[model samples]
Target: MTIFWTIVGIAIFFVGLLISIAWHELGHFATARWFGIKVPEFMVGFGRTIWSVKRGETEYGIKAIPLGGYVRMIGMLPPAPGKTLGRSRRTGPFQGLMDDARAQSRLDVLPEDADRQFWTRSPWKRIVVMFAGPFMNLILAVGLFAVLLMGVGQATDGTRIRDVSECVVPASVAATQEVEQCPVDAPPTPAAGAGLLPGDRVVSFAGRAIEEAQGQQLREAIRVASGPTPIVVDRDGVRVTTSVNIIDNEVQDFQDSTRTVTAGFIGVSLLPDYVRQGPGTVATEIGSMIVRTGEAITKIPERVPAVFGAAFLGEEREPDSPVGVVGVSRIGGEILAQENVPWQQDVSLFLGLLAAVNISLFLLNLLPIPPLDGGQIVPAIWESIKRNTARALGRPDPGPVDAARLLPVAYVFVLVFLGFSLILAIADIVNPVPFFG
Candidate 1:
């Protein structure tokens, strides 16, 4: 049953991925048509075409590989200097590359497409067309997050006691054991000694009530107390007051396990709680996700060594480390196979994963490197700047910045990206990170 659900989860994620890819290409396709650019193909994948149909001048299709997709727009790059379409007679050091790029850009150029080439459009229109793809991913991410956070709600902990600890032990000792039960020589937990039971709704701790959601006051009071502290609970509709002897215990630091601090301890776990968030909270979460993802993307170069070590050597991969498409899909499968997980929780987690994937897509494609949407955008922006400067200096419009000239750079970008992707893929397969554990 677990295996069946896991396969189902992978299939669901793959379908979601295809939808995301198609949605991204649709952005480019729709905007290119809107700006009068000749779109020759709108494909949902790469490599050998599985199916296709010609509609007007454009061919819509699906391909074998489901990794990525693209829309082929006419004249994506301006012609090479002193070179015309189908009459390329140049072979300088890198001239042939630029010429080939220009030639390929004109592959679907018909007589009417002369005016419909992407380069013929205004720079602003080109920018819009290029920007639309990433924007679609951003829209999908926000919508998913809104549905998960506002509609489904986030799981948290409440003030009610789920379980009372049997023994008092240092966090260092607790970390070494699977279940820290009361030893014959060890003392019982403060909550256990104080006669606190499961299902007790903690009304106040040391005169402090629930400060914020998730029983913040109780946590703070437990951490700060030095000795016996007064606690009030509502047990079975009756208010009960009790005192617990707080013990000085070694607690593990939240960020670093090597570090420890002495704090008050009264061992009791909180009951499961959930709080449905508002638009403001969802927006905040989205902003944080974007910032965190951007930081992670920037750290990719630094992480290559770690990825290499994990893939080649026997080093364990970090839980929060970067993952490729394969890694994320495996994680989706794992999420579905989790033992005893509720259906709603599984769906929520799947939605969250999809949202994260879209967020990553939004950020990665916006990078100012060639072959990506951002690369095309850079040329358009430069063209706009040059045209404005020419108007100011009483010069003629220099025309579209010869994007063909950057063909070599774009090729390099593709190679580097391919190399990085290959490494991540290998690492994902060999040393997959335990995302949840």
Candidate 2:
């Protein structure tokens, strides 16, 4: 059953990925066609063609690899300056008999014409064609998120609390009638040393029914305990009894005006769980995902350096550092395997993640780095601005860009990006961090 679910999850993930890529490419193809640009080929994936069919002047095909798709349009980028236009002539008797001899001849080359070319289009048209793909991705993400939000209600969980320790105020402060009590570094100091494990919920201490106030009292008792005392805890719904003797320990809880005081100590933490609600929808979920993703992206510059430093220093960083495709698939599989999560809830979560991934892809592609959609758009914008400047100064238009010089730089950048991506892929495969861990 686990294997079956894993396979299903992987299949669904790939399907979503393919849809994203195709939707993005479709935007480009549609826009290019709208502007009368001659699209030579529209294909999903790359490398050797698996299937193909020619329609009108374009060949639509699916390629072997499913990583990405593309729309090959004539005059996509600046053409080579030295390349001459091909001229065709027919001398056979069949040429004079047929008026459309040039069009019929498979061996004949067609001359390049300005009117039918993408380069001859206005700057606005070119911009629209280039921007359409990422724009479509963004739209798709937003739409999915909206659907999710509408299907599922938004609610905060206990995990969202900034500090679990602060949830309960120190009894010492309450005793003193102070508005704010000095924080205590009181450790779990389990009343008994019965080998209590981490994540064991303190259901009661000394049989006092451990509510918030009772738990605080237990902590105070442990702080003053000089001898072994009994402890009781709940581990995943199983009751466990333990005992611990408090040893003299000094720790700082909060840094305030003057001094730090010593408090009881234990080394266990409470695990937090999400409080589920049913007011979520596709739209709302997508929106929430977008907002969270944007916030995450904004913090990257501040966070990446710290992450790298911790990794270098061999610090125990959180297991949920960064996840790639493998991590996502594993999480998807886990979600599918869990019996408690309802089918609609599972679908909502999957769609929400899909929206987030698509949004990230859209933003990444819009970065003005080499070999990206934005990279190409930058030059086009510059060209337009330069032409406008020349016109204002009463000069002739500066001619097309030198594609030769830029193409090499673009190629090198693409190679570097691919290498970096390969490294990430390896990391993802070897150490897939589970999302729900």
Candidate 3:
């Protein structure tokens, strides 16, 4: 059963990842189509096609790898030579015959000089097409976060005390007279060597029902007990009766702004009750999450430099390293194992995390590094500026870019990025600092 559930969880996580990737690529595809660009192929994933079908001029397909997707647009980049014809041999007898036949067969097709080709479109239009993918990813992240916040509501664990040292304890009024030492911790404290297991729920103390107000009274009863006081707890829905000895102690209640006079130390943590939210409350909570996520992203540059410097210098630093697929899968499994978390709630949380990941991917890709969209846009902008200057000087616009000169630089940058990603992936696997942890 555990294995089955783990597999299901992994499958769900992978599906979500793929959907996020597809949504991002869909943005590019849609924008290209809107501009009347010739989209020769629209594909999800990379590598050889696993499934494909031609729809009008576009060949839509799914690839073998689900890591990323793309839409290949005609004239967006240099065109490849025909299967048997080399680029330099475009006018050979055989090539000429084939070209003539191809040209004649497509007599109704739009001429090559048509403005629909991506290169013929204005530079601003091209920029829009390039940026749409990342923009869509950001939109998806915000939407997912909003939905999750609205659906599940937001609550903090009671263990995180809003007011320091202030706590509610249970006691019986009739049995307990003057309080001596109250139980400091409910289940177990580090000092007492007592600990609460996963499924324990407090029932009552000294025959008194454990209510919100009566908790303090119960502490007094425990303090006054001559010997071990009887305590009742429900574990996994089964009632278990036990005795806990209490030690006398004076504790400060910061919330009350006073010291509590009590006895007996029973070490247990306070657990918070969930407060459900209405639609309006949910909207507010979601908005808060979005704001927080945005702020966190903005801090990455500052935080990442410090972290990397610490690692390089071998200095003592917080172990908040990145986690790769292995770590994420482990988290998904653990979340699935947790009891009382509704399926929809779990799905919503998972999707929110996935969206955040996509947002990161989108932002990372926009860095002005070679082989990225930003990198390509940089040169395009420079060329556009040069062309405008030349036009003002009454000179002819520079001829089209020579692809041979750019390919080598792009290839080198891609290799460097791939190498860096591999290093990070290895680091993540060996030294994972989980997000939830």
Candidate 4:
């Protein structure tokens, strides 16, 4: 049953992935058409086309590889100075590469498309057309986050006491065993001695109302009490008042398990609750995710060595290391197959992962490197600046910036990315992250 559900979850992720890709490409295609640029193809994959339908000068299709997608617009590159449009003329070393790129870019430009070519549009329009794809991803990410926060609700530990401990045992002893058994010398837990029952909703402790303060404050109140403290709880529609002797004990720090701290002990466990989060909570969480992702990207140089070790040297994989698509999909399968996990929780986690993926896509596409949307956007912005400056100085309007010159740099980036992807894939298959455990 777990295996079947795992496969189902993977299938669902692929479907969601296809939808996201198509939606992203749709942004480019729609914006390009709006700006009068002739789009030849709108594809949701790479490699040989598996299925396609030609409609109104655009061939919409899915390809064999499901890695990425693109929208092919006519004349993405401008011709070199003194060169005829759609014609390639190589004059020096590596010039052939530039000429071939320009020629290939203009190949789909028909006679009527000469006026509607992408390069023929103003620089601002070009920026909008290129940026629309990533912006679509950002929009989807935000929507997913909103749904997860407001609709599904955030899992939280509430003030209700789920269970009370039988006795108080030393934290140092508990750390070394699966279940710590209280010895004759151990003291009775405060909650147990106070007769606090399960399902009791804590109202106040030491004159501080639980509803008006955070859980940490309540904890601190218990820790600081030198003697018996008054506690109020709601028990089955009735308010129950009691006094519990807050005994000082060495307990494991709630935030850090490795260390122990002297605090007042009341061994009551919190009950689970789903707290509805506001838009501000959603924004804060998303901002934290973005910062963490940026930190991960910046640490890639330092972490790549560990990836190689884990892939080929039988080393343990780091939990916080970067993962490729394969690793993420494996995690998705594990998340779905987790035993005893409710369907709602599984769906929430899966949606969260998908949201993170979309966020990554949004940030990656905006990188100012060629073959990426941002690379073209940078040149368009530069061209806009140059043209405005030339006009202001009474000089001739400069033609569009030749993006073909950066083709070699784009190729290098592609190769490095592919190599890194391969290594990560190998690491994922052999030393998969133990997310299930």
lDDT for model 4 comes to 0.84
Write candidate 1's Cα lDDT for 7-97 as tens digits: 8887878889999999999999999999888888999988999999999988999999777899998888776555555545666678777
Best by lDDT: 1
Top candidate on TM-score is 1
lDDT of 2 at 294: 69
Work out the TM-score per prediction.
0.83, 0.61, 0.60, 0.81
The candidate, 1 or 3, that scores higher on lDDT is 1
lDDT of 2 at 392: 100
* Native-referenced Cα lDDT, model 2: 0.61
A best-first ranking of the candidates according to their lDDT comes to 1, 4, 2, 3
Residue 85 lDDT (model 1): 50
Candidate 1 has its poorest 10 consecutive residues by lDDT at: 79-88
Off by over 4 Å in 3: 78-114, 158-319, 325-330, 339-345, 387-406, 423-437
Kindly report which residue pairs in candidate 1 clash with one another: none
Worst 10-residue lDDT window, candidate 2: 155-164
Report lDDT per candidate: 0.85, 0.61, 0.58, 0.84
**Candidate 3 residues 101-190, lDDT tens each?**
334423323676355666666666777887888788877876666566555544434221111122333334212464345555643332
Tens digits of per-residue lDDT for model 2, 84-203 = 342224344442333232223212223654455666677778778879998998898877755555444332221111112322334344344854533465343332235665555666
- CA deviation > 4 Å runs, candidate 4: 84-92, 159-252, 257-271, 341-344, 434-437
